[model samples]
Target chain A: MITFENIDVVYPNGFKGLSNVNLQINKGEFVAIVGLSGAGKSTLIRTVNGLVPFTSGTLTVGDVVVDPRSKAKLRRLRSRVGMIFQSFNLVTRVSVLNNVLVGRSADTPTWRSLLGWYRAEDKELAFQSLERVGIVDKAYMRAASLSGGQQQRVAIARVLAQDPEVILADEPVASLDPPTAHKVMRDLRRIQQELGITTIVNMHHLDLARSYADRVIGMRAGEVVFDGPVEEATDEVIEQVYQRSLTAEDIVTAEATQE
Target chain B: MVTTSTAERRAAPQAATVRPEPPRPSGLVYLGLAGLAVLAFIVFWVIQESGDVLLIPLGFVTLWAPLNPVIGLVVMLVALAVCFKARIGTMAAFGALAFIMMSYWAGATVGFTLLEIPERWSNVEPRLMAFLDPNWSYIWTVRDQWLITISMAVVATLVGCAIGLVLAMYASPVSSPNKGTSQTIKAVNSVIRSIPDVGWALLFVAFIGGTAHGLGPMAGILALLMFNIGIVAKLTSETIDAVNPGPVEAADASGATLTQRNRLAILPQVLPGFVSYGLYVFELNIRASAALGIVGVGGIGSAMMLQLNRFQFENVAAILIALIVVVLLVDMFSMYIRRKLL
Candidate 1:
């Protein structure tokens, strides 16, 4: 379970990244947080992995309380909850398999991993994870050579290879085209369902959240303005949360184009 | 009328709502100041060196001829300044040219007024040595000396680099990971670097003198090794510091232990730096080994000093050229590897 109870994140430079972000995500839940730029969606997700330290807040991932002040605890927590980013974040020069194997570093003995001697079982696990994401064929290919959608898939495989219980994806499809974005979201949703891992995805497209998420979270000005089941998250509620006039044209256009 | 108004509004430009003054030409003032300053210096320097002539065969060259040594001389001066600033190549070529043109002729003129050893000594090989010099058997006699010194240089370089590399890894900010250990390693490296190679040779000669059969070459090789280690480490650290933190972070977050992260994540990224730094140190050590010979460590440097003392300039020429050839070849290889890295 990942929970943020009145979490307040003030960056050292005095930027209020997340303010009173009270939210909860249960195990095996597929929740999507939607917001425009600077809306605290990323900050909320990053809290789970302890990457972005909240200045004042209570964030619990599983049983561990994330406190950036405690480096060791943060590192231990990071090893459990795998993260995927917009940029793919795989080493550009390394091969796809090597990139996936890095996900195993959290579990391997330090010296054996250091000496490039990953256990045989770890290698088998890496291959199996690649197969799950439909990229086992590109195992030896350089991560840089793959297309954008392929790269995102490779990143998913890397997290899959981690065998992480919860995955946090921050704008995972923002850099991708619409078709590729849909495929990646579908893949993430399918994988999360199959693994029964609690998955939280930060998304920009309203249709993506509606299509893939069991629950939708809408944030505005560093606070959750709307949180409910997909069925209850109506156009009026989205309009209130976004503080923009939602139109019938938007719904019609979004639906038509996604076809 | 309404449709035309809408089209006009669209044509008016989205950006026309605000116009920012093109960023002021702030760079021009600096350029103008620099140009004026350069002009002033030329005028002032010309006035200072008024008596020295800068004669150019401008008219003759305009008339039609290829060899304009004056223009060539100007090119030479500019190239020398650039080489001095950037160190474009080995210094030997410039040093040799200076000796041939300036030192040989100018010193002979001074020697004419000073010690006056006949105008003809000119480091010329005399007929006596040419006729009496030993042939094939002499090389066979000295083969053991050559082999041992060559083998010692190789062993010393590898052994020294192994120790140096381990130390460098610890001394590097990347390897230490923490600030305190990194600072301590830097202090030790600085102390090691301050002792000059010659001082090392002299100290070793005093304690570990050629008491053992081949200790003379051993001592020279060791000093070269120590100095080159410092040079390699200093050159290599920047690459280590500049290593992409993303991969390392990925490895770390994956639960990689520090050693595993370095080997799996860090080493692959830094391989190019290692290759280039290793070759650069190898070249430096070669030249250094020759210098080490002067402190009773056996090599061409000692041989040159011996010939200089005996006034046997011909033998010195042969040895200097051989050493230059070796240095140049190594320099070429280093250049090739560096090009590949970039």
Candidate 2:
């Protein structure tokens, strides 16, 4: 379980990234965080991994407390909490298999990883993870040659290799086309179900969030405006989160169907 | 097998459209060609018969042993043909005239000076042979100093590159742990870069060699180290700055420690550039080591100086040949490594 109580994140430059944010997510649940640009969605996701340090808050991931001051503790927490990015940030010049193996760095010995030497078991796990993502055939290919959706799958395989308890995806499908976005969303949903891992995705498209997530958390400015089951997160609730009427672009399927 | 004329075989395409033929040169082009040819012939005739005509160029033509009329005519015709084919008729005519005229005037005065080379070589041959008469004895005796030169460069390159890599990592703002560390490293890099290799060599020689009179190789090694640091730091730091930040972010998101992030994310991105710069600095150090020897900092440069000062051309030549061979071998090796890395 992950819990946040009165979390306030203020940048060194005096910009408040998160303010009085309080939330609790249960184990093995799929939740989607939705908001406009600069609405603290990324900040909330990053804070779980200690990438964004909270100024005044008590946040807990699984059993350990989130403390950015303690590097050792942060690494320990990050090991069990895997995060995926919108850019699918695999080292493009490297092989697909090697990019996925980067997730195993937390487990692999420093010296062994430094020397590009992974144990047979680590390689086997990496290959299995790739197989699960349906990109086992592209394991040897360079990450740069793969399309954006394929690259995002490689990134998913990377997270799977880590075997994390919770997965945080910050705008995972923001860079992909509509069809590809749905494909990736299905992959995430299926993976969450299969592994019984807690999945939190920051989504731009409201329709995708409603379609994929069991629960939805809405944010505005630096505060959470609504948090409820997907059935309760109506079109009016989402419109209130953005403080505006919904446009065709706000619905993923609306634009996708028009095409 | 069947054969058809190209035009006949492609007649169907030609029947579709009547394409206009390219325009041929006008009568004015032929007139210009004729006029250029006549001018060239006149110049050729004048160059050949100037000696008899008592023309102004006769004085220049008589300066050297004049070319035979037949050879002169052949050369003029060949020159004209080449010039006209290249469409430089008027310019070519003027150029040919000026060249012939200048050569005759200059060669006449300079011709006798060339004879001195053979005369001087004959007198110097025995002296040169007498120096090499010992059959590589001098080279063997100086083997210890040569080893000093070679070993100093090797050690300096290895140590300097190691230090430089660390300095470069911290100097890059993108990969640096903090702004203060990056700024401090960059300042140190600039200070080191400002010092010339020879200046560093001279300073080390004066400072370190004051008490130890024979530690010239030590001075050379230290100087080469400074040069390597400056070069490698500047090159690798820029390379680090230019590296893609995506992998670095991914590494962070995966919970990699700072060391792991830098080693796996940052280093691999810039490793090729780092290796290439390291090899380049090594090649530079080899050449600079020789230069350092001239200022009493030990290397082949000092040996070459000693030989030249004593008029030992044969030994000087041998040292030069050794330097060339070593440099060439290093150059080929560096090229191979760079090709593989890049």
Candidate 3:
């Protein structure tokens, strides 16, 4: 279980990223946090792994308390909580198999990883992760050689190799096309279900959130305005959270149809 | 219809005949023009004061030589013509003027005179002839020294590159453990690079003794090694600084330790650049090692110095030909490797 208690994040520049955010997320639940660009969706998801330290609040992920003050504790918490980015940030110069093995770095000894001496079990787990993403054939290929969709899949494999208790995806499909975005979302949803890991995704596409998430949390500015089951998040409720009426650009499918 | 359209276009310009004024040159341009005038006056005064007299100063000896006034006047005239005709910005015009002045001053200080070449030609003829018909037997005599030079360069480059890789990691801002370390390494590297190869050779020879003590090649290799470390560390650190931050962020997010992150995320990206720099530094070391020999360190240069001291121009010419061929071959080989790697 993950919980945020009265979270308030004020940046050094005096911008409030999150204010008084309180929520409880159960294990195995696929929650999508949707908002406009500066609505703190990414910031909220990052707080779970202590990537974006909250200014004043207590956060707990599984049994670990998120504390930025403790470097070792934060690293330990990050190891158990995998995060994926929109840009699919893999070291393109290296092989796909090596990129996946980076996911096992936290578990391995520092000297061992530095020397690239992965144990047999770690290699097995990496290959299995690659197999899960259906990119086992490209494991030896350089990451730069793969297409955008394939690279994103490799990033997913890297996350899967971590075998984390929770997953945080920040705008994972923002750089991808509509079809590829849906495919990646489906992969995340399937993996979350199979592993029974709590998944928190930050998305701008309302339709994608509704399609994949069991629960939808809507944020405006720096506050969560609406939190309910996907079925209850109607157009009016979404407009209230956005503080503006929806446009065709707000829906991924609608934008695709226009194209 | 075409004529009508042309007439309409012509009339449209007359209808808006109130054109905007062209912008005026700033006060800085006028200031530059004044500066140029002052510079021209200074040059004229210098020529007037130093008319037709050149002094060549050798160590503890001074020789009086003749300077041709016509050459100085012509050079000045051409500089002035270029400054006026080029119609360049004030800074560029001043740069041209400064370049001309410096060249003239340098020539004067060196006692350059066209009249001396013909007057001295007879003295140089025998030596030139000896160089043309080099002593072929001299090759066997200096062959070992040439090999020693090549060996010194190879050892220095290999060891320097290995050590430089580690130093670069600390020097680069992106991969450094702390800002203080990065700054300190950069400052030290700059100081090392500032010392010339010959300067390093002299310092080492003074401290470690010379060829009499049988440590000539050792001094030469140490000099080249220091130079190589400075260059390779600087270049590789710059390459490291330019690596993409995206992968670094991803590694940090994966909870990898700092050492693991740099080894995996940063090293692969900078490896190609580092290897290319290594090959380039090796080429430089080969050239520098030959020069180090002149400072009493054992190499082909030492053999050439010995032959020159003995007035054996033919022997020196042979060493020169062989050294040129060797340097060219090394250059081509290093280029080929760099091309293949990059």
RMSD of each: 10.7, 11.5, 5.6
Alpha carbon lDDT of residue A62, candidate 2? Answer: 84
Candidate 3 regions off by >4 Å? A10-16, A254-259, B1-35, B43-49, B53-124
Tens-digit lDDT track of model 3 for B197-222: 89999999999977768999999989
Total backbone collisions, model 3: 0
RMSD of 2: 11.5
How do the residues A43-78 of candidate 1 rate in per-residue lDDT, one tens digit apiece?
Answer: 888767766788886888888777877766766777
Q: Score the docking of each candidate (DockQ).
A: 0.36, 0.46, 0.71
Name the weakest run of 10 consecutive residues (lDDT summed) in model 2 chain A.
A250-259
Give one digit per residue, the lDDT tens place, for model 2 in B8-65: 8788577688887544434454455445545644565564534432122466474444
By lDDT: ranked, best first: 3, 2, 1
The TM-score leader among the candidates is 3
Best by DockQ: 3
Q: What TM-score would candidate 2 get against the native?
A: 0.70
Tell how far residue A257 is off in model 3, in angstroms: 15
